[model samples]
Target: MSGARAIVEALEREKVEYIFGMPGGATLPFYDALWDSKVKHVLVRHEQLGAHMADAYGRVARRAGVCTGTSGPGATNLVTGIATAFADSSPVVAITGQVAKAMTGRNGFQETDVVGVLTPVTKYTVQPLSAAEIPSAIRKGFYIAETGRPGPVLIDIPKDVQQEEVEMTFPESIQIRGYSPNYPVDVQDIERAADMLARAERPVLFGGGGIRIADAASQFTAIAELLMAPVITTLQGKGTFPEDHPLSLGPIGMHGRAEANRIVQECDLLLAVGVRFSDRSTGNFHEFAPEAKIIHVDTDPTEFNKNKLVDLSVLGDANRALTLLYDALLRRLAKRDENNAWLKHVNQVREELKGIPAYRDSYAELSGPKIVKLMRSILPPEAILTTGVGRHQMWCEIHYKVLRPRTWITSTGLGTMGFGLPAAIGAKLAAPNVPVVDFDGDGSFVMTEQALATAVEERIPVVSIIINDRSLGMVEQWQRLMYNRRFVGIRFQNIPDFVKLAQAYGVQGRLVGSLQEFGDALREGIRSDQPSVVEVPVSHEEDVFPFMPPGKGIKDTVYGTSKEMAVF
Candidate 1:
């Protein structure tokens, strides 16, 4: 069979239901093979969106999402999307076409070194030398992408190799020497962590994206409850735990939950699970968890002392580590005293933060949180929400309480704009029965608004809720707070009519001016069963509050007009 045919067969063997990409000259052979294959191809408007779609699919489906693009600019365009996946550890298999093997290093037409270009942004990159190596490369790409710390993997196939005829049989199993993502946790380490938690007066659980990646949400909850600790998730870990639960403090860090920040500050012992403690999350590492003895658990050992040094480091899978910790704690709890006062104090702080004057508005203008709340009421509970990075993303994180794992997807570490629409398309494709909404800012949405055409054409019905403030809200807020409100290049003088833009792409569009209009539009869009855009004109003057000034600790949170709000 031909190499392209073998590639398609390998994708089928992997049970890839959808392959998002666009056809180009170098990839025509692969597209030809796809014509007879059962794997559905979604032709995106741009290669970047194709990659973003695959990233979301991988996150939602808990499998390696596959995306394809041709050589040269086609491959280069996928760089940002692949990097976004890498930053957030989303598993994706990115396949790019290359020049014929014979034309190597000859500056052939549309030739570019895809593997070299993508090496930094991918978990692994391979340029298959021959058609015979295609199957193993593809299998290894998927394996490397989905194992350990999940990340994007790139495979560049030469054009000649695709057309090369070879005797190919899908390998039953493929192995890479000395590559292992999973490791056993030391039983002694688990016992030590359990003992620490058992004796702690104030304990907190810090969860990260790895919890969701490991499918350890239940185990994490068990451990948190076993210790009676307040739980604070990182931005990437927002939906990994039940936010509405009393023990939950939501996300922590800069632009994190006020209660979560407070809990972290006061805790004496922190069980850090699957978290890297990024600088953004721990502003000024010296001041972060000063009083806490952290017991860190992660699959990657490199992450142990890379950020904040912990008293104990258990290197293992999040699920297994958390499960073992829970059991160990149960065994060690006989002499422990109830931390009821700590829980009550944390709950009081949570309530006080909810009532803080900074995060609340007088309902003078349509706010992002209010819009998120209205949309939440209109959309089904099981709907998957994807968001572009900005004030709108913050609002979704703050107001949109995700009830299940994988229901909330966002560009966390990379904080990439224009991630929403494409990701929403992928999420909807991954779970057709579940509704998907892309919460986007006007500035962020415009970056890849072109993806709407793909959504409409492919029949990927996703509702894009554009919080149209006619400005880059997040940057504007930052300038307002940190830079004397000198909004340079932050304000949008000319705003496109998003409804008209959606209509141009054959998508249903609605312009919502008021809260009522927003709700009505959301209901209408959700019922349309078609790709649509609901443009909500939020107030440009409104800012995402409870802001933590740069270089300052979370305790120094500021609100409207740079007024410092005292965090308990």
Candidate 2:
């Protein structure tokens, strides 16, 4: 059988249901082989969108999503998408076609070093020298991409190799000599951490994306209840704990809930689970959790002292560590003091923040945060929400109530701009029964607005709520605050009407002029059986607040104008 056939057979063995990609010269043979296979192929408008689609699929499906691109420019186009997946620890297997192996170093047509280009952004990069190695490479790619710290794996297959015939023998299991993913929890570490939690006067639980990746939301919730600590989720960890829960303090970091930030400031002990303590999460890091003793639990050993130092470190899978810690804490309950005082304080903070209005009295105008809050009130409980990186992303993180894990999706680390629309398509494909919505800023949406055509063609009914601010909203806010409002390339004079653009792509479109219009449009978009875009013209000057000033501590956050008038 041909190498292309062998590749398809290996994918079939892996039970790959879909492959999102674009077709080109070097990949013709592989596409031909795919024609005879059961694996459904989703042709994307761009290679980058294909990668984003695969990344979202991986995050939602809990499996390695597959994406393909042609050589040279096509491979390079997949770079940003792969980096985004790598940064967020999403499992994706990206395959890129290459020029013939015999054309080595000659700079053959459409030739590029796919392996070299993708090495920094991928868990593994392989270029099989022969068709015989294709099966092993493909198998190992999937395994590596999904196991341990999940990430993208790049497999560069040359054109000749795809055309070559080889006696195929698929490996049932792979053993990479130096690769080991499983890590057992240290009981002593858990005991020490539990003891710290038990003795603390004010303890807070900090959860990150790792908890969701480990599928340990239940265990995390149990631990939170056992400690009776107020839980604060990182941006990537938003849905791991129900936002409406009594103990939930919502996200704590830059642009996080004011109450959550204040509670973290007052906590005496912080039990950080699977959180890497990114700068955005920690503010200035030096002053973050200054009053607290932090017990950090994570799978990666290198993350131990990479950011903030910890009083104790538990190195293992989030699920295993959380399970053990929960069990250990239950045993130590008799000796531990009750957390009534801390619970009362947490409740007070929550009530105070609730009374301190999130919006101004003049918010009759349509704005991102108001839209996000409206969606939270209207969106189905099981609906999956995705966001492009910007002010709108922060608005969703702050105002959107995420009730379950894997239901909230966004680019947390890389903060890719054009991630929302395509990612929403991938999320919808992964779970067709659930409603999907993408909260996108105007600047971010236009970068990959072409993806709407793909959704229309594929019949994916994802709603895109575009906050049309006519500027790079986040950067404009930063420039206004830090650079004396000297905005350079921030404003757009004449832009394509997003509603008209969507209509041109055969998508249902709506222009929202008021709050009532927005609600009507959103409901219509949600109920529609086809892809739709809702463009909301918002104030270009509106800012996402509870803003932590650049290079400042979390406690030094600026409440912005009109916020000072807020009362509790």
Candidate 3:
């Protein structure tokens, strides 16, 4: 009846199927207990990877993903991953083993005050003093992390507390003083929101991560079509509605399509669902959609006033609020607005951009758009798309549009590398029936390449498509165009033969030479039903266009890549 065993038993009773993390000194007890537990432990090469895996797992599972770390450095290592979850509203529970209680205030080894440092990132944090409270704290952590606008929660367990024996009974439900996940929606509010949508000359539907979390994709599509409104998404909102849909306007903020941003600016009425007004997606707040009369629906009320002013606020679950609003609109016999003039204007803007960021072919080599298209063709509709940070992630966000909500996962906030592979594994485990693809750059892959061993040992089926160019491609692109091409130390050399390296880890590997070869290679990986790696030989000279220079807003974006390809 040790504390570690009690905690493990509680986790089992709660049916937490997976836990992602690395082992460190203070966390030895939990690791020892993990060995004897039935829950699957995904051993990531780094704590950062562990957090990313948990974040991705949360997105796919529609539940709180769990991760573990040791005291001090171990806990701190997970900061980036946790921050990503926080920014993106990906639910995750981060468990860290702390130094013994007696040494807590004495500056003991590996004694970093994690709860203090992580306050800004986590939805809630608990440092349980008694083993008896461990289960309660865990239950509370999950409830807090997964409810409302989801984010990561932290639980700090002292080494001694972990070893102490106590009766363990995790509560099935929790009640916090200031926390109430289920909110009441007034009928009048829904009426007002409907009126706002119906009275508009030109309306736009702006969706975010919340749309996916609320499982309102169909609702979103229906609302957009019924109201005859244009739809745009934040980065995390890609694929919330099928990109091919006529009403869909790709990602709409900075680095977003020029037309999408313009549409956001011009729309008279904006129905924002399950999304925050992120700076990247809104440009400068002052000039952002000043004309739009916005109806904001979100689980978090605090977010209402954080950005664009809300003309009407509906505080409720996005799915429920949207359903009610849809019904209300229909009940009122509302007539959809004739926004054809606005739509035509937006389409004109889209046509003006030589490359609409759609699947297009112009250059000799495959473009980022082409890469995502080929990948979509290979993977099933339900496959999970994971990515490392940088322009590559943006490319996928712009192009890959197959899956449903929770299907696309990444380290959005921290933009951490070494994240994609480990996260792909977590995703595969959560949705074994679906293919898990990690779209990453060579620099991103190398940051946590050791994850190949985890794939080897666990026999987890995942396909890693490395957009290898052997450079911090994103930064390199920025420096080249904005900083006089003093490439500096951006270039990398002596990289491994990823295919052979996969063999070392007991997994299948292939190096693709061209688009045709890449197509075949991706097909084999998607069909093989086994863990594998595919290295795509992209041009080191290749760069993502439509580049928005660092510090410059979306308006300052390069119309296309070649335009920004500065030669020193």
Top-lDDT candidate index: 2
User: What residue runs in model 1 are displaced by over 4 Å at the alpha carbon?
Assistant: 334-339, 563-568
Give each prediction's root-mean-square deviation over alpha carbons: 1.9, 1.8, 2.8
Give the residue spans of candidate 2 off by over 4 A: 334-339, 355-362, 562-568
Better lDDT candidate (2, 3): 2
Sort the predicted structures by TM-score, highest score first. 2, 1, 3
Model 2 — TM-score against the truth? 0.97
lDDT winner, 1 or 3: 1
TM-score of 1: 0.97
TM values, all candidates: 0.97, 0.97, 0.93
Q: How far is candidate 1 from the true structure (C-alpha RMSD, Å)?
A: 1.9
Clashes of each: 0, 0, 1
Model 3 lDDT tens row, 271-362: 99887787767767767788889889998888896987888888988888888888988876554654567777777776776444332453
Ranking by lDDT: 2, 1, 3
Q: Kindly report the root-mean-square deviation of model 2 from the true structure over all alpha carbons.
A: 1.8
Find the 10 residues in a row with the least total lDDT in model 2: 355-364
